[model samples]
Target: MKPLLLLDVDGVLNPMGRPTIDYRRYRCTIGTEVYTVHLNPRHGRRLLDLALSTGSELVWATTWEHHANEWIAPRIGLPALPVITMGPGRPRSEHGEMFKTPHVAAYAGRRPFVWFDDQVWAEDEEYLRVSQGLRDFLLVHVDPRHGLTREHLGMAHEWLTLTGFSQGP
Candidate 1:
């Protein structure tokens, strides 16, 4: 089984939930709550295309799952893909399972995995710091930017190759 690509949409794909040049930031209302997020249809398309071409399965770890598929995915030329939904595999946390990484293991069937998110940090840099199982999963953090910038995409592509998620970047 290929390790799953546990992706966060806002900062990783759509850019940080803020305003900036090159992209316009907008608030997205999902369910009863609203969140500020950036959207670049081009970046979304490239990400979707990369994942598809690499044969990497993208499981949503972001709250944007509901609207991501509805509006964003279509703009990127992709149908709604299966989302991991809420927590990947861990019990819900007081943080509403946002820190959930265990689920990546389950979602990936314990295969080598890479998690791309702005939320992961030095604390979670080494999986040993989080969990023994997570030690094998690659966690890549993206800097806050207007949208999914080229730097992050390059890192994602490189990490994917290193983890054997795909052959070429």
Candidate 2:
């Protein structure tokens, strides 16, 4: 089975901490709140290429949830991908792990997956290593100050190839 690629928006795609010059600003409304986000246009193509090369399904794992599809996808030139639902009351781990860790593990189930986010901590990694029992999984932490860079994409591609998910040409 192809691996799953979980994507986060704020830090991974939007890089909110970075200078505004690197992205195009857009104003979007989610629920009753109107917010502005800066998204790098090149990242969509990079992500799409990674997904296609690895035969992995791209999924939205951001807090924005479905709103990512509505606002971020179009701006980045990505189609609407599946979103990970954050149910009532945030899920937490006993070791101060990320709230999304359990949800991501549940979504991945027995499937091999890769998750990209800025907030992943060592606790989350330890939780996955001990509890998830995943043989082939990658958790990449992208710097929010830089978002997704070509170097990051290269690392992901290398991992996919090393894991036998991509038959590089």
Clashing residue pair totals per candidate (backbone < 3 A):
2, 0
Q: In model 2, which runs have C-alpha deviations exceeding 4 angstroms?
A: 167-169
lDDT of 1 by residue, 17-48 (tens): 56555454566666788776556656667666
Report the error of model 2 at residue 56, Å.
Answer: 1.1
TM-score for all models, in order of appearance: 0.71, 0.93
**lDDT measured at residue 123 in model 1 versus the true structure, 0 to 100:** 51
Task: Write the residue-wise lDDT of candidate 2 on 1-169 in tens digits.
Answer: 7788899988888775755676998899988999888888888998999889888889999899998999999999999999989778896567778999888888988877788999998888888888777567788999998787888778878898887876434
Candidate 1 backbone clash number? 2
- Error (Å) of candidate 2 at residue 59 is 0.4
lDDT (Cα) of model 2:
0.85
- TM value for model 1: 0.71
